[model samples]
Target chain A: MAQTFSASELKQIYDFALDLGRRAGRILIEGVEKRTGDVGEREEGGVGGGQREKMNAVDIVTQTDLDVEAFVKGEIERVYPGHKFIGEETYSAGSSKEYLIDASPTWVVDPLDGTVNYTHLFPMFCVSIAFVLNHVPIIGVIYQPLLDTTYSSLVGYGAWQDDGKVGGKRKRLPLVNGPKAVLPREAPKGCIFSCEWGKDRRDTAGGNMWRKVDSFVNMAAEIGGRGGKGGMVHGMRSLGSATLDLAYIAAGSFDIWWEGGCWEWDVAAGIAILREAGGLITTANPPANPETDPIEEVRLGSRLYLAIRPAGDSEGETGRQAQERVVRETWKRVRALDYARPGA
Target chain B: MAQTFSASELKQIYDFALDLGRRAGRILIEGVEKRTGDVGEREEGGVGGGQREKMNAVDIVTQTDLDVEAFVKGEIERVYPGHKFIGEETYSAGSSKEYLIDASPTWVVDPLDGTVNYTHLFPMFCVSIAFVLNHVPIIGVIYQPLLDTTYSSLVGYGAWQDDGKVGGKRKRLPLVNGPKAVLPREAPKGCIFSCEWGKDRRDTAGGNMWRKVDSFVNMAAEIGGRGGKGGMVHGMRSLGSATLDLAYIAAGSFDIWWEGGCWEWDVAAGIAILREAGGLITTANPPANPETDPIEEVRLGSRLYLAIRPAGDSEGETGRQAQERVVRETWKRVRALDYARPGA
Candidate 1:
């Protein structure tokens, strides 16, 4: 019924998938610059919440958002009709929230990575898609249309981009320099760090977010001889786009990025892109396996990821140790808002 | 004796000084593209303890950085040489602590802002220069070399910039789209916000920088519709440079921006630029005039500032109310962070 293929066949499939990502990126870029592609309020259609649930503070959705998901889903279906395809809007619409993620070579698509930035005409958004076989991201493509940059990665093959844009194109996501740049150098002590303003208010049960932000900014001010107190991080930035944020880390454009409260669709494609760019993605708490499966870990929402561009070139073990230190220090700074999460 | 001049004469002086800001910006852009600037690290001359004692950052001190500062200072001196000049490197080299602000019309300059980005070839930094009269930012000039963006503002001149870059041919900073675009909206349940990470940390005594970051990010997350639990403030972002971050708000690129640990050099000129765009800048707590001496109540060394561009351009009465609401809401967020600064 389905056409099965060999290793070469898989390579061809990946190549085609990469082409599709580029094409989609072009379409998105053209759409953004056009006045016609505006998401004006639909006064014509009565306000309906079903089509778009409150994603969070400062975020909204629409049928078009869902339509983009469907478009990508269909594109994958048309190419590899037998290959499993999973996307966000469909999951929200369907009864199964599992995403049906299987090891049997699936394509993960996040049609719109930063919906909030898109709605507001902010330029730090992207379209992310990943192809995986045996639960490893064999091929990944991430495109930020507004910024006109696309990042892609393939298993063992390595990660790269079209050219320098958004977060620079890199062999590894960050392509971080050596000891003078990475190890022995102490990770610059102070620099620009990134993360989104996820939920979990200090007034809530999941107050870890509040604690993290507080410690982060304070640390940023004091760190790195940037003119404040600490030299741990110079600055902390959040661009509202997981795809672009993670891309920044892989490209070595940004030093580090820690995130939580995101779905697989939000980070799946970027994860591969970052890893390919010589970056490491780890957990926020224990700081392990940034590439760990997005399973429901304590919370059912279960989508948290921490990505960093280590200074080491995988040969040296210092980067790993630096990452470990960062996590421990960050945890020490966090003072749990709600004390509900297990780690707290 | 200091040469005495009328208030309008002071305004003329500001005009001439801002002229040099644009010129400095041009040179900076060329320097960046050509990478043709010379970089020199100072010999670690000054010895001051307490905090600046442990400097862990390596700044790219270049001719471009100094040339711009010197040029701006020269222009000011040519018009009124008696006025003092405070710059990033000059301040530390000359004085151990800080220069006197005793009613002197001082020019604070940060030549070649975003040097790290400039060196690494990222394009988000700019040149910031502010004219402080007796403490308040009387006039300011900010320019992003690459973007050809120049913002000039005086206490009463209403602030403006040269649009589309016609070789220093200045024009009133046009309000984007609607006049409201120049104004700060009610931080829609889901809007885009911007901030920066300064050199602050939890380890520093009496400095709640860590808490500030946590609260700020949490506000972005918790402000309503999507990521957080109840509220929505759309999205949050942080571009590395404080001047550019403020300029973004003035250009209606961002709704609100909050920062601390950033020196007056980073934001003094930006504050004028934001206010010129009909925005509000004030202390994060105690809600007072950030333009004057209220900075003392602002938790010394912790430079907390909140700026909100008013939407719907109503400066007479309603505009004041809009400014009040923004300040209040910003205060509310700060309070949230303060409570969470030490961590929840």
Candidate 2:
């Protein structure tokens, strides 16, 4: 029953969504500094008076996330009333099996991507919205309000960043002093890498994930040449926010971020920005016998991610090769972990 | 004999040292980023031209660190003339017990605190400068230039933060925005907690840390919770820089961070900041015999660490008691590994 929109309409629609996303971000910023000192009713979120919606048992979902999502969903519905939609906490009840198995256009959203941080009052979460067409993600926008950074792209506009500044002084991002000057380079060991724990409570993939992370630490410090004892990894860091993690990579804050078990909504926006910054996103664990084109299957919630910064001072191929090496190392690390002793 | 001076003279000495530290930081930042991204060079830091000065295998001593120390030493001579100085990379050159071993007022500096991060281009590193009064750190200033975060304190006067903003004014921080707000009355099953790699790279400690992290995840989503599957650790993050890690604890971004194998200098400034932010810093692994003292033991390089936000959120008398139950549960998780087997 949804009406299909043209390409120009789609860009305009996404642009509108970005506006609402920024507004929501501002509200969150104001609320975080307010509700986060000493004590407040925001804790024990309840259905009753003074209580906000609490996600799961511990995460405190504030009016901010709810308010933000409502505003976001409203704008989407208003512009494209007939389009199919899905959201994190609220959309589940109305979700159908068709979206997963069908070939229709659908919109997926995680308004406040890092919900726990939002609830606990940590500041790095983001607003993620993606448009999928015929089962392929074609339009995405990842906006992190706190840092005032935005990543967005339409199938071929190429990826770029817009400093989420107020008003419309949209500056095309990566403010690269030069284009094509950037390239992917070898991932330096002894640097911080980012990862997360997906909703899988059972320790199935948890154990394996830990092994991979542990090996990453060793590799980073081992390369640093610390005598007494230190992994080549300089240090390992998990910032608790996907949007910011990718932004940092774009800005050259953290060297590499290998992660898994995240949804497309979580990465859609950042993907655009990372790409704009000249980074590559690949599968962390592609099968040894991959299908004809395994790259086509990479999706959010697929439990695999490897993103490397496109080096700023080298040839493009160098950057491409560097990212590939990191991908291979991540796999090797995984394999090493697989063969590691049971106790490990 | 080492000369001693008044606080005013010490202030001048510190200023001079700070200048040297900044110069060293700039050198490191440039090398890590612009030089070349080589994981091998990172892992095996050999002598290189332009800003790099390699030491022996398992260790790297950049010219920046040495130059900074020399500048600091010269300034110290200019200000206090004979103040004793001891540095990490320079310790081996002398056997004189008078500097490190003997109890004398000394300036202990980790020119590059997170050296591996420096080598690998990871941003979780710092310049640690602690003025030890007779081997006890009295005045501490840990500067993370890349992030423009400066944590400084002189015992009596409270701690402060100078945002990474180069030209920005110094801000009296905890930004208090201080202390974590108390959890809502009915807290969720699992909350976000952070754990990190200890200097001890043993499989047992490594396995134990993961078990503890897993316990938090399982506790969060414990089945029957909305949006949670039994394990729901909001998120796990590691920034690689101990200085930054501890600083985040002080800043309240991290709810809890458990670490091991760090020194007094590594924590002194942040511990003060964490306490100022109303957070608790305790032993990650409780001693067989519990002690209720605010500070304990001469075992920093060997023991584990546990830093919790809002210092006194839990009603229990000790951090050990708060996390003790989880520790027991973690034992079984480690059983699969021989190093973690009983009666090692």
Could you report the DockQ of all the candidates, in the order they appear?
0.14, 0.13
How does residue B68 of candidate 2 score in lDDT?
60
- What TM-score does prediction 1 earn? 0.68
Score every model by TM-score.
0.68, 0.65
- Which candidate number would show the highest TM-score if scored against the true structure? 1
Query: How well is each residue in B203-297 modelled by candidate 2, as lDDT tens digits?
Result: 33445434443344434343543233343444666656676677766654565566654555466556655554445565555444333323443
lDDT of 2 by residue, A1-344 (tens): 33466889877766776676677677666555444322331233211112221233222345566776787778778977866777764644454422241345677777787776665544467787777666555666776654465666565444445543222223333322222123224344433466654544334444554445444544444332323223334345667777667666654446567776555566655665566555677766645733332443345445456676644434435555555555555454542222221111
- lDDT for each residue of candidate 1 in A169-194, tens digit (9 for 90 to 100): 22333433322235324433554567
TM-score of chain A by itself in each prediction = 0.74, 0.71
